[model samples]
Target: MQIMDVLAKLGGESGFALFFMQGGWKNLVMIIIAFVLLYLGIVKKFEPLLLVGIAFGCLLTNLSYFLGHGENALYHPEIWANFLDPQNTAAYHSYGYIMKNAGLLDFFYIGVKAGIYPSLIFMGVGAMTDFGPLLARPKSLLLGAAAQLGVFVAFFGAVLLGFTGPQAASIGIIGGADGPTAIFLTTKLAPELLGPIAIAAYSYMALIPMIQPPIMKALTNDKMRVVKMEQAREVSKTEKIVFPMVVATFVILLLPSTAPLIGCLMLGNLFKECGVTERLSDTVQNALMNIVTIFLATSVGATMVADNFLKLDTIKIVVLGLIAFAISTVGGLLGGIVMYKTSGGEINPLIGSAGVSAVPMAARVSQDVGRKYNKNNYLLMHAMGPNVAGVIGSAIAAGFLLSVFG
Candidate 1:
């Protein structure tokens, strides 16, 4: 009778058995989705640097549900539930409680909760950015600013769809096509939606090549698409060194809430341009960036536990995110057409799509589309002007929303 009792306890505790008893089909579906993401990241090379980590994190979080209620599980939904409550005054205390009890995944998540990882990632991006294109063609800033039209449009769309003000703001930022910005805003306004928003942002960012080309072709005719921009005036090294400081000072003074993100971005740019901090710049651009990407991607993915992620809300977020992206692309293209007309055919409308802020990816798509029309027409440098400007534009827009809702 004792031996039978021992066998019964072992069977009850086994993860294989608990999988069926606990989350059931939802867990299985999430696990399969995780594997599909892994396959896309690894085999198909879809944003492998971040997606692989995200997929692994998703796998681990879903697997925790099968492990029975124990310390070995990487996530605790009950603990997470307390933090999700918007009005919970003791959210910080609950975070501390999770840190003391839960496993290492929860520990890494502190960076997300505290909004550290996004700022760090922005710093790294700044370290890698070259402001020469933007400085040479300051007019591109208008295109960048114009592209953000989608963000506001999506905000109203989300609000009309029955989301709260903060949640609507979070969803609208997906139009910016900036993953870190989306994560940063979502963490502040709607922490619970962080996973889906991050995934949607990055997924769209990776698909920029595929998504933007069709839109670019559809929006601009053959004549406008093939227009070759004049060579940008050479930007002096002193201008490059001074631009970050001036822009950072101006934007932050105008909107103090953007200091954390825009401040770090300019700091990294200063490290690069100052010519005295090559070591720091290199580290920020490469080593520090890689490390933070791992932590940020994994923490984001871990938030997508089956129970919370498999809801109607997640589906809505996904749909809304896609719509936001499409609208942002249209806004950028429209802005480009205006510039094309204003410049009297000197400006290629293709470069305008770079205003969506997918960095080099959006810029590259612009270049590719231009190449299809005329082989000698290179739009990379010109597109880059709006590409980097879009980064600053999105950050400023996020600050505006945060001031109002956060």
Candidate 2:
């Protein structure tokens, strides 16, 4: 009788037995999804740095949700749900309560909820980035701004689909092809939708090589793709140093909500451009970036607790994200075409597709496509003008959306 009782207790504690319970299936399903994401990140190498961390966090959160009982669970959704509830005013955005009751993920999530990680990530990006290309060709700013057309288009589409203003804004930012900005905006406006938005943003960013090529080919003929121009004029050290300060002051005055991201970005850029701050620049570019990425990715992934992620809304978000990304590419290419015509075929329209802010990757795509048509055509430096500009454009667009909706 004693042996039988012990055996029964052990069986009840097992994961298989838990699967029979209500809502247990959702956890199991999420775990499977986490496994698939892991495979994609590890085997396929899709944004491996962040994706692998996110997948692991998802796996850990879901597994702990079931394996641990009550207050001991690695993530407590109820805590976050309460944090967002108006009725629980005492607990609303209350980090104290979270720190007291929630688990490890909840602790790491503080950086995410407080908007620390993404801003720091921007700082790192700015530290590594050289705005010299943008400074050389001021026209690249037009292409970058034009690429943001998808953001507004997707916003209106989301509204038509019955999403609220804030939700739509969060969804629209995926068009920027900037994961940090997307995560930053979503956390502020639609915390509930963070899981879907973050995944969509990163996935589309990783697929830029595949997604942008078709759009580039469809929009441009051989002549447009092959056109190359003279080298950009050199940018002086003074222009590089003054650029970040002037932009930060002007932009922050225009939209105070942008101060965090824009300020940090410009500050990082200043560090890189300023001759004295080599150590600071290197730290942000390497160590700080790597650390913050791990925290941000894992925290974002923890939100993928099955019940929140497996909805029809998730599918809708994925589809809309793809549409927004495609449209942004189209918008950039169109802008490039206009420049090509206006310049009497001196400008290569293929370079315009790099205006979606995926850093050097987008610019490289432009170079690859341009090379395929005319091997002598070197569009990389020209394409970089718009590539870096897209980063600023996306941040400004996010600031606008936040000003209106936040």
Candidate 3:
């Protein structure tokens, strides 16, 4: 068969054919990546729920053009049939035009493109979060602040690696270990890098247990790791009710740009804390959070088309993401050490992992590490103090970057 004839059988000449010729090789690469994400999420239980859905979502948009399904389709049944009849190519072109004119994810992606998904998520976070631990142990806030060292370090690293200032800022926020914060910053500063940054942030967050144990063990001795921390005092209900509002007002007053994330986050917490608002809080935390998570994950995953996501820059993002994670880990450990020294060695260093702001993941890792050294020590509660603080600290860092660069 002639080369041109062979090419014709693959998909027939047109934009789809050109797309295959241009992006087909990379499409296979992304499929392999999706399978890996699926395997990691499934067998390993690494963010199983999210990565599974997101992996399939990534594969969907990528495999679409190959099916001759046009730009966006929930279902596309024309694969071999488009090639068997050349007349159909022209016929489908007319249909594809109609679909394009109809508009699909173009609007959906706008929500992502404009930085709306993460803000909505922060609202849900406020509703679900328990600020009692943070309020009871304000010093843990320092650990959260220390964890952000990695963000600035990674920003510089990205710049050194040839990314522009705003792009580097977007990439570095991944080190904050805050997925929504990373997305929020990226959509504003470097939307082009959003797909890889979001995926990498969430992936590393899910991998926290695997990544942190060795680092914690390497930095801590048996006695220090085993050091028992005092249980946190039960926080007052009044304090919980007021904390989010105070923080939100503080952030909004000082840094209005940060209010989008902080305001929604605090408002959710307000509902959670307010005794009269259980029904509202429950809806915001459980129903609303889950729904937004589905939309956010699938929509973000849709952006991972092979042409956009499989560039040389994707490799750089992956590498930079690893750097961000590693640096954040180190920063957490250092914060633990600093706090331990400040308190004359009373503070357990494991709490430093919570500084990365992966919500409970890093905190859980701290608890596990403490348990390894002493079977009964429950550092999870204590680690939570720093864990939540990291969220605020990262937000502030994001704000700083925005203020300086925006």
Candidate 4:
């Protein structure tokens, strides 16, 4: 009996005795959630480029205690958080990570603590994206604007729920279907909510085909799906090259704050346009973009550990994210329908759904749906107009929100 008691005492003393800050219930739940995200990213290939890196990071961040790292919470910047420490005061006055030893959060905070990395990612994105489609069809810019009705509408919805104006705005921008925009806005507004907002934006962007087709089919009859579109006029190489520069200058002059983001996006297009910079443009679009994406994804997921994301708001963010995405799709589809009616159906009604900034996926869905009923239907060229416009419109809406609630 004495020997057994000593053994039990040692077991209790050396292992598994720390009280979980949030309790075992939340701990178990969060681990399972992280695991699911992992499976989705790994096994299912759902946005593998991002999801995998994020999943791995999340797996690490969630274990309040993992591999003897000795963490009991996400982080504790308490020396500074305490606000009364002499050593910390001098430390706080200095620039950069004085509280580096505080906890696991220090690293996650590195990616999102300031708005720096997201903006860098945007520069890379700008260096990659092509503005040719929007340039070829300027009117599609109007459709992009229309699709943003969802961003503002969702912003209001978040506000009614007691989020600050900036926080609400960050959540709503996820509807823009642009990952960098979501990250950029959240970095300014609610950095705490970054994980959900980014996860939602990227997830839904990848799921565009899944989310959109049901909405599209319901809003239009079978007859509308088969409506043929006029062939897009041949775009001159000169026109594609000049389009990004013109749009960028016009936009920055109207809304200078967006210049950092919008400027980069257009600049990338310019690289593609100039022809002389084909090598640079190709490198930006391919290699540089992929590297940035991996960094962005891993850093974003590192924020998703159990402590931050297992809250009620995480669920709210996800649920509201879907709502926001649905709204954008409807807005785009309605815009397309109106355009079709106004143009006497010359525009493929299918192209309207591409107004969500899911880029090529939404555009491809338009083609797929069109082909479903009409085998010879080729809607890809037509869909490019609104597809490109959606990116610009999303950026503008972000600008409007930041200007108002920023």
- Candidates in order have lDDT scores of 0.88, 0.90, 0.78, 0.74
RMSD of 4: 4.1
Per-residue alpha-carbon lDDT of candidate 3 for residues 1-406, written as tens digits (9 for 90 to 100) = 6987977776664444555564467767777888887898799887765677678777666666443345455322232124224576553434443334432443355455556778878888878778788898898888898888779888999999899999999999999999889888887787668779988898889888887788788887776787788777788888887788789888889988898889888988898888888898889888877877776776677667666787888888888887888788888888888788788888999898888998888999998888887898999889988999998988988988888777
Which number leads on lDDT?
2
As for candidate 1, its clashing pairs are none
lDDT of 1 by residue, 291-337 (tens): 99999999888888887788888888888888888888888999999
Predicted structure 1: lDDT: 0.88
> lDDT tens string, model 2, 72-158?
467777888899898998898788888888899998888988899999999999898889989999999999988888888898899
CA deviation > 4 Å runs, candidate 3? 1-20, 66-103
| Per-model TM-score versus the true fold | 0.96, 0.97, 0.86, 0.86
lDDT, model 2: 0.90
Point out the higher-scoring one by lDDT: 1 or 3: 1
Residue pairs of candidate 3 with colliding backbone atoms: 126-268, 126-269, 127-268
**Residue 273, model 1: Cα distance from true site in angstroms:** 0.8
